[model samples]
Target: MKKLPLKIVLLFTVLFASSNLFAQDFQGKAYYVSKTTMDMDEWGGRDMSPERKKQMMERMKSFLEKEYVLTFSQVESIYKEDEKLEAPGAGRGFRMGGSMTGGPKYKNVKTKEVIQDQEFFGKQFLIKDELKTIEWKMGTETKLIGQYTAFKATATVPVDRFDWRSMRRSNSDDEKKEKKKADKDSVKSTNTDITKSDDPLSEIEVPKTIDVVAWYTPQIPVNQGPDNYWGLPGLILEVNADRTTILCTKIVLNPSDKETIEQPKKGEVVTQAEYTEIITKKMQEMREMYGGRNRGRRGH
Candidate 1:
């Protein structure tokens, strides 16, 4: 029988311990506070009287401030808003403009899959599709967001033209009628012009891109962030997208109790493109129905 030398035994013991420590998964929970400042003038709030504007601002305060929790493991994360009672008159008829926040979003970096639960006009849809990739251009700029020193990165993401709110706002009756007449004229002219191959409706233009700036901390060393933001070299502590800003207020790492990160299964499963089409078609139908009712009232 033979025994290993003292040096070899100690080396093996150290390597075994290091392997176990590295193998243990790291989990973290991040608390984020989101605040949106409303541009009263942009949304027609400026047209109201002083007292009416004040009332509107006060009423919208609760809806603008939101809280979200992001629970993340090494390769998976789930981001969801903290449940709270809806504000009074929240379910009333549609407002002109509102926030762009979606619903519970789940991402798996390992599998490169994203599952987003979205609700539109009382219908639930599970947007199950590949994660949207961002070609982030990292900058040399650095800033401190809370306790973490973060680096800056910027990217341009395409805005979905089929967004219900944007579509509804843009598709007024006058615009619809004008577009229909123009479309008909173009179709008749196309017979004379053999070069015309594109559909007039498909040529309609909308704002295509949104600018996103993110501040991430290498100290955390995890590629996870609020909403659909990811792919940074570190954890994103702050994000500024258009008018919205999401800041991380607190982070808890490797807690004693672990929570499960389960993918949401309840909803009509659809791809992002399909979901966009469904919403677009539904909103068009609603507009037509409402327009018909208004015309009937006018006739009476």
Candidate 2:
């Protein structure tokens, strides 16, 4: 399976649905998110042994020496009607900074942030998706989502992606070589397109996904919506639960021909993919530089 596009998640809303989907009728939506999670894992810190911690601090200083900081940017496109909106508007995102856990098992890591680019708005928003919870025979229920009715459903995501990291970790060594060759070929073809710009930010590219959680009015038609969770057969009004939001905020059902709902095209500017890349590269360079300096000191 090919990697799904940030805006084309609608295809997935139905791809894995059960046979009874004909009864449902909802559309899904997507959004950009500015979420942060903390690193709670033991390996996420620079304090191990004093000597080790000291060495790590030196490495950190080198990486941060580039003055890396998280900035917001737009990624991916969303289209429910298949046409473009000047600016779809904006929403709130959750913060996930250093609140995650890392273990020695997980290689050297950093306190990082991630955002997903998907939101829902319609009649119902998915509250929880458990594994194999959709069996027609059995499932649990809960009303924790306020006055609206809610139930438990499960959806499984398969392992499939075409990103640089995914390609590098593929099991087929031949496939790996092919992918590298392909990337080199692509880079060579487009290297000239890397126009020389007076501004450093001009050369940067952004990722198109935001981690969002939306709320919906269950009274509306039910149809599994746009992106990956179309199995429910109701418009997805919210996503990520507490991470990001895309509430109706305000919706006008019908108005005169003069009425208009202009899209939004403004806000904090940054790209998660680019941000991750820059930070990772800086970290790697810092490790090398710090290690080199430490070696020189030992030799002295």
Clashing pairs in 1: none
Any runs in candidate 2 off by more than 4 Å, and if so which?
1-144, 158-218, 222-231, 235-283
lDDT per model vs. reference: 0.72, 0.29
On residues 1-300, what C-alpha lDDT tens digit does candidate 1 reach at each position? 899866445434534553433234888899998877766654556578889877787676656667999999769999999868886876344443333336889999879999998876667778999987888997757777777667789999887775322221235677667667855664555243221122222333346777899988766767889988999867889988766789999988887898888898878899999988886787566555654554454446
What's the lDDT for candidate 2? 0.29
Model 2 per-residue lDDT tens digits across residues 150-224: 333333333212111111212256654665665455444533222122112221222333233333333333432
Per-model TM-score, in order, reads 0.75, 0.27
